[model samples]
Target: MNVLITGASAGFGKALAERLVANGHRVIGCARRLDKLNALADTLGEAFLPVVMDVSDTASIPQIITDLPDNFKQIDVLVNNAGLALGTEPAQNASLDDWMRMTDTNIKGLMAVTHAVLPAMVARDSGYIINVGSIAGSWPYFGGNVYGATKAFVKQFSLNLRADLIGTQVRVTNLEPGNVAGTEFSNVRYHGDDDKAAKVYDGFKTMTGDDIGDILLWLIESPAHININRLEVMPVAQTYNGLTIAKQDS
Candidate 1:
């Protein structure tokens, strides 16, 4: 199988790419950082093809897909993993630029890539799409703001896409993960504040990127007739926060 993973230079995408390539599947790894992708290419060897692509650039995605080498062109699996959160501030205090950037990459980019890839899958009547979503989409939290909204869009879009692809063999899944550690996720969220990022998982046992990779491998390798629609994962240390209220003397 040929797999195309976005944000493949780091975190979950990188881990998934490694897992797929090691299992004898060809992988097309796409990301904005050429140096990081190239370094990964060196490590993963010829089985992993590193392609420089910014998913947020909606106009360029189709062209990139069209330009792939022969062996990697027919993408049997598409993992929409390019996304991030910026500014852990209340909506009233968040930056507009941060909101727009998150919207561009998380919503528009995912839509563009899916629009570009789904047709071929429908035509072939065989494909799998794994969308890397977040638990924040289903359960809101303080300072989640636009990031949470974007992932909610992902969750709904995946379900709707599944509805639309009912006749075809094409499958869509929304994988919602919670509180993963050992990735640039926190650093990026905290805008390079290493101490702040480190504190998020300082003592808890958080899920690693490799764990997600393993889950993805299983999902893709499952029987063609079976489709796991949504898989929400959280570490043992995490759980739903439930409701919160402030009490005062009457």
Candidate 2:
């Protein structure tokens, strides 16, 4: 199978690309960092095609697909993983720019990629769209703000796709993971504050990229008749906490 993974330079994307290629599947790894993509290509060899792309840039997306080599043109699996969370501040205190960035990458970007690829899938009546969502989409938390909203959009968009493809063989699944560690996620969220990012998982054993990759592999290899709608996972160390409330001075 030929797989296309966005944000494939780091985090879950990189790990998934490595795993898929290792398992004898050809993968096209897309990211904004050309050097990083090239480095990944070096390690994954010919099976991995490195394509420089910024998912937030809608205008250039068409070209990315058009430029694909003949062998990699027909993407069997589309993994919408290019997304980020910026500024952990509450919505009122959050930067509008950060919110817009989140919207652009997480929502618009995913939509653009899906729009570009879905037609082909529908035409062939055989494809899989695995969206990398977050538990934040379903469960709220302090400072989740726009990031959570964007993921919620992902979760719903995935379902809507399934609704529209009722009779088609194309499958859409949303993998919502929580507290994943060993990725640039926190570092990016904190805007390069490595110390702050490190503190997030200081003592906790969190989910790893490889773990998510394993799940992805399983989803892709599942029987054609089976369609796993949504799978939400979190490390055993993680769980929901009770809601918080503040009382006024009595």
Candidate 3:
């Protein structure tokens, strides 16, 4: 199968690319960092093709898809993994820029890429779209305002795609993972404050990119007739603590 993964420069995307290539499937890894993608290409050899892309840049996505080489043109699987959470601040105190950035990459960008790829999939009547969502989409947190909203959009979008592809063999799955560590996620969220990011998972054993990669492989290799709509994952160390209540002045 030919697989295309966005945000392939690091974390889950990189892990997925490596795993797919090792399993003898061709992978096109897309990201904005040419240097990192080149390094990944070197590591993964010919089986991995790196494409420079910024999902947030909606204007260029269609052209990039059109320019794909013959071999990688037919993408059997599309992993919409290019997304981020910019700030941990409450909505009232959050940066408007951060919200817009998240909206661009997580919502508009995913829609653009899916729109560009869905036609071929519909024509062929076979394909899979795996969206990397987050638990924050379903279970809200104190500082998870816009980021969670974007993921909620992803969750709903996946289901709606399924509805639209009802007659075709195309499948869509939303994978919502919680507390995943060992990724640039926190660092990016904290805007390069390494110490602040490190403290997020200080002593906890959190999910790794490999874990997500394994899940992706399983989803891809599952029976073509069976479509798993959604899968929510979290480390055993994590669980919902329920809603918080602040007592008003008495």
Candidate 4:
């Protein structure tokens, strides 16, 4: 199968691209960092095609896909994995810039890629769309804010795609994960504050990018007749702490 994964420079995207190419599937790895993508290509061989892309820049997406090598143009699987959380501050205190950036990359970017690729998949009547959402979409947290909202859009958009493609063989799956470690996620969210990023998972056995890649492999290999609507996963050590209320100071 030919797979196209966004944000392939790091985190879940890079891991997934590595796993897929290793398993004999061709991968077109898309990201803004040419050096990193080129480095990955050197290791993955000719099966990996690295395309420079910024998912947040929706306007450039069409040309990027159009300019792909002949053999890589027909994408069998499209993974919307390009997204980030900009700030940990409460909504009222958060930067407007952060909110807009989250919206652009997480929501608009996903849509642009899907729009570009879905038609071909529909024409072929076969394809799989794996969207990397987050548990934050379903369960609000202290500072999830706009990041969570964007993921909620992903969840809903995926379901609506499933609905619209009811009679077709195309499948859409939203993979939501919680508390993943060994990725640039925290560092990016904390804006390069490694100390603060380290503290989030310092005491926990969090899931890794490879673990998420394992799940992606399964979803891609599932029977054509099956469409796994949504799968939410987290480490065994992770769970809800229940709701809370704060009383006024005495």
Candidate 5:
């Protein structure tokens, strides 16, 4: 199967791309960073096709959809994983820039990619879409604000698309994970403040990108009759976002 993954420069996207290639699947990965993409291509050998494309840039999507090499013409899976959280602050105190960025990337970018690829999938009546959402969508927090709202949109959109594609071979699944570790997600959200961002996952083990990658591969390889609509995976340490407690030394 030919697979396309967005935001393949780092984190979940990169891990997923590596796993798919290792399993002998042809993979096409897109990201804004050429260096990372090139490195991925080198590491994955001929199984990986790395493209420099930004999911937030909708205008360039059509060309990407049309210009796939012959080997990737029959794309069986698309992973919409190009998203992030910006400033962890209350809505009232947050930067408008951060809000816009989140909405543009999480919502608009997702729509653009789906619009570009869905028609072909629908025409053939065979494909799987794995949207990497967040538990933040189901449960809100003090500083979740726009980021949470964007993921909420992802959850709803996945359901609506599944409804619209009923009876067809296409499958849409929303994979929501909580508190993943070993990803630049926190650093990006904290605007490159690695030290400040590191505190969030300090106390215990958190889900790794490979964990999410394995789930994605499973969803696509399942029987055509079965559709895993929604899944939420998190480390035991991340019971729930609302269960926070302050510790006091006696």
Candidate 6:
């Protein structure tokens, strides 16, 4: 399959891209970091194609979409993994720029890529879309604020897209992962405050990027007649709900 993954420079996107290529799938990766992407392409050889794109730039996306090579133009899978959480602060105290960044990437950018790809998928009637969301979409928390709201949009949008393509063979799947380790998420959220970011998964084992990547691969490789709509994965260190952390550190 010819696959397209955004935010493919690191974390889950990079993991997924590597795995797919290893399994003989051609992958086109887009991110703001051309240097890192080129590095990945070098490792994967012809299986990996790098496209420099910023999801937040509305003007640049359409042209990039059209410029895909003939082989990649008929993309069989699209992974909307290019998103971030900025500043773990309540809305009232949060920076407007942070909130806007989240909305732009998580909502507008998602829509832009989907709009550019879905039409072709619908016409082909044989493609899959995997949206990488967060458990925060369903269960909000302190400081989740706008990041949570954006993911909520992702959840509902995935469901609605599925409804709209009722008769078509196009499939939409949402993967909401919790407390993933080995990613740039915390760093981005804490705005490079390494100490605070490091504490997020300090005491416990967390899910790895490859774990989520593997789950996604399973969802796509399943029979065309079967559509796995949603899957939520959480690390074992954290149990159900608010039970996991109930301590006072004064």
Superposed model 6: Cα runs more than 4 Å off = 242-250
- TM-score per model over all chains: 0.98, 0.98, 0.98, 0.98, 0.95, 0.95
Give the Cα-based TM-score of candidate 1 against the true structure. Answer: 0.98
lDDT of 3: 0.94
Give the runs in model 4 whose Cα sits over 4 Å from its true position.
none
| Model 2, residue 157: C-alpha shift (Å) | 0.4
Task: Please give, for residues 84-177, the per-residue lDDT of candidate 1 as tens digits.
Answer: 9998999999999999999999999999999999999999999999999999899999999999999999999999999999999999999999
Q: How well does model 1 score by local distance difference test?
A: 0.94
The 10 consecutive residues of candidate 3 with the worst lDDT sum are 201-210
Query: What TM-score does candidate 6 reach?
Result: 0.95
Model-by-model lDDT, in order? 0.94, 0.95, 0.94, 0.94, 0.90, 0.91
Q: Which residue pairs does candidate 6 place in steric collision?
A: none
Tens digits of per-residue lDDT for model 6 on 17-74? 9889989999999999999999999999988999999999977888999998887888
Q: Write the per-residue lDDT of candidate 3 for residues 113-213, one digit (tens) a residue.
A: 99999999999999999999999989999889999999999999999999999999999999999998889999999999999999999787999988988
- Residue 211: error of model 1 in Å? 0.8
Error of 1 at 46 (Å): 1.2
Candidate 5 wrong stretches, greater than 4 Å: 241-250
Give the clashing pairs for model 3. none
lDDT of 2: 0.95
Candidate 1 has which clashing residue pairs, if any?
none
User: Which ten contiguous residues of candidate 2 have the minimum total lDDT?
Assistant: 201-210
lDDT by residue (tens digit), candidate 2, 50-155: 9988999998998889889999999999999999999889888999999999999999999999989999999999999999999999999999999999999999
